[model samples]
Target: MGVLTGKTALVTGASRGIGRGVAERLGRDGPRIAVHYGSDKTAAKETVAAIEAAGGSAFAIGVRLGMPGDADRLWEEFDRHADGLDILVHNAGIGTSRPFAEIGEEEFDRLFAVNVKAPFFLTRLGAERLRDGGRVVNISSGLARAAAMPQLIAYAMTKAALDVFTRDLSKELGPRGITVNSVAPGIVDTDVNAAWLRASEEAWQEAAALAALGRVGTPADIADVVAFLVSEDGRWVTGHWLDATGGSLT
Candidate 1:
């Protein structure tokens, strides 16, 4: 049996990119995964199929975030499937690379609403259903600590806020043996960045050069780090922001 054979995990935004990778990885460990998707039901089903093909269990849950009743709606859907949660992976987020001066109020509010507010309320309500010794892993970005991309200022701010939430939540949930952490990744080659990173050879090379490892990162690279965090081996680690940045921040 896998380490998480009887556990349940909820991974938001599992329809694609890093979230998809996390969902699949955790599924491999035997957790009954709740694959949450914002609007892509087909992609979510594919994620669930992939897990099942690997001898894992998973089900899809769809709910649009950044709205008033997002968290509540998600939990209501979740209630139909499982009673308790062992892992909560907040991987759903939106990004913007517009220069600080050009960004409008509507854009900034939407960024915070989806990226920060959604996760905050999701955890607040989900925490009651999260069992003791459960895991809460927030998929943060290296920009939270590094000012490498000035154009992504607003996106960076949201991640920084998430990191703070991880730290404070860890302390608050420590007594229950729950662990909260933020995993920061740098220049991951996901659909989110494909437009720019894969647009030209020079762009790709420049992005690769940022990582000390001599290549851009992949979803699986971040997923492996997350897998370790939620496993029994990571029991003693909490309230920390892990740099899964391939030495970019170093």
Candidate 2:
């Protein structure tokens, strides 16, 4: 039997990248999965199908992560698909690399809405249905503590805010037996990083150099850490970031 057998998990932005990888890994333990997507309907369906083919229970739902009323619609679909919630993964986020001086108010709002506000409210919604001893893993970035890179101020700010949420909420949820934590990934090779990956050999090599592992990260790398964090072995871990960063922050 899977470690998570009979559990229900909701993974936002699960249509692709690290989220997709985590969803697939968790499905190995026989948990029902709600794969939430923003614009990639086909990709989301494909991910769900893959899970089902692997003998796991899974389905896809759509919502614009940063839009008004999106959270309500997402929660409603989640209710229909899941019997109850045990694990909640806030994996949906957007990244921008514009100059700080050029960042308009609208851009800032949009970035925070998706990267911060959506996850905050989702955590609230999940906490209501989350069983005692449930798990919440907020996907953050290594950038939270890393030396600043170009065009990532607002994005990093949003993730940095999540660290606080994880730390503070761990204390609040301790009595309930629920564990809250964040996973900060470094230079993960996802479509979101495709532009950088394909930018030039030098750029890719530089990313690799930053990692002690000497390579940019794959979705599976981050997923493996997440799987551990939400598993029985992770019982003693909470209110901390497992730092899936390949030691880049070091």
Candidate 3:
């Protein structure tokens, strides 16, 4: 039996990219995964299928984030699938690279709504449903700690806010044995970054050079770190911003 054989997990934006990787990893650990998708039912189903194919249990839930009542809808759907949650992975987020000067109110609000507000409210609504010793991981970005990409300033801000939430919420939930943390990844090779990262060998190398490891990160790389954090091995680590950037910050 896996370490999480009888546990239940909810992964947001699990239809693709890093979210999918985390979901698959947790599912492999034996959790009944709730794969949450935002408008991509087919992709969500595929994620669920992949988990089940690996001899794990999973189900897909469709709920578009960034709108009013999103948290309510998400929890309502989750209630139909499982009795309680052992893990919560907030991986659903929207980002933009628009320069600071050009950022409009609508764009900024939308980013905050999806990236910061959603997870905050979702956790609040689901607190009672989360069991003791539960885990909460917020997928943050290295950009939140470094000004490497000025154009992505707004996006980075959202991540910084998430990290703060992780720290503060950890304390609030610590009494119940729940641990909260933020995992920051640098330049992961996801579909979202494929267009540019694969544009040329030079572009790829430049991105790789940012990390001391001299290689671009993959979804699985971040996934493994997340797997460790939500496992029994990570029981003592909480309320921290873990740099899963492959030494990029160094």
Write model 1 residue lDDT over 1-250, tens digit each, in one string: 9999999999999999999999999999999999999999999999999999999999999999999999999999999999999999999999997988899999999999999999999999998999999999999999999866779999999999999999999999999999999999999999989999999999999999988998999999999999999999999999999999999988
* Segments of candidate 3 deviating more than 4 angstroms: none
Pairs of colliding residues, candidate 3: none
Stretch of 10 with least lDDT, candidate 1 = 144-153
Q: Candidate 3 overall Cα lDDT vs. reference?
A: 0.96
Instruction: Residues 172-197, candidate 3: write the lDDT tens digits.
Output: 99999999999999999999999999
In angstroms, give how far residue 38 of model 3 lies from its true place.
Answer: 0.3
Q: What's each prediction's TM-score? A: 0.99, 0.97, 0.99
Which pairs clash (backbone N, Cα, C closer than 3 Å) in model 2? none
Model 3 TM-score is 0.99
Cα lDDT tens digits for candidate 2, 1-250 = 8889888898999999999999998888888999999999999998899899998999898988888877788888888877578888989999888868788899999999999899888877667888998999999998899997658898899999988999998998889988999999999889988997879999999989999989999988988888888888998899997788898977
Looking at model 2, residue 196 earns an lDDT score of 75
Q: How many backbone clashes does candidate 3 have?
A: 0
Model 1 scores a TM of 0.99
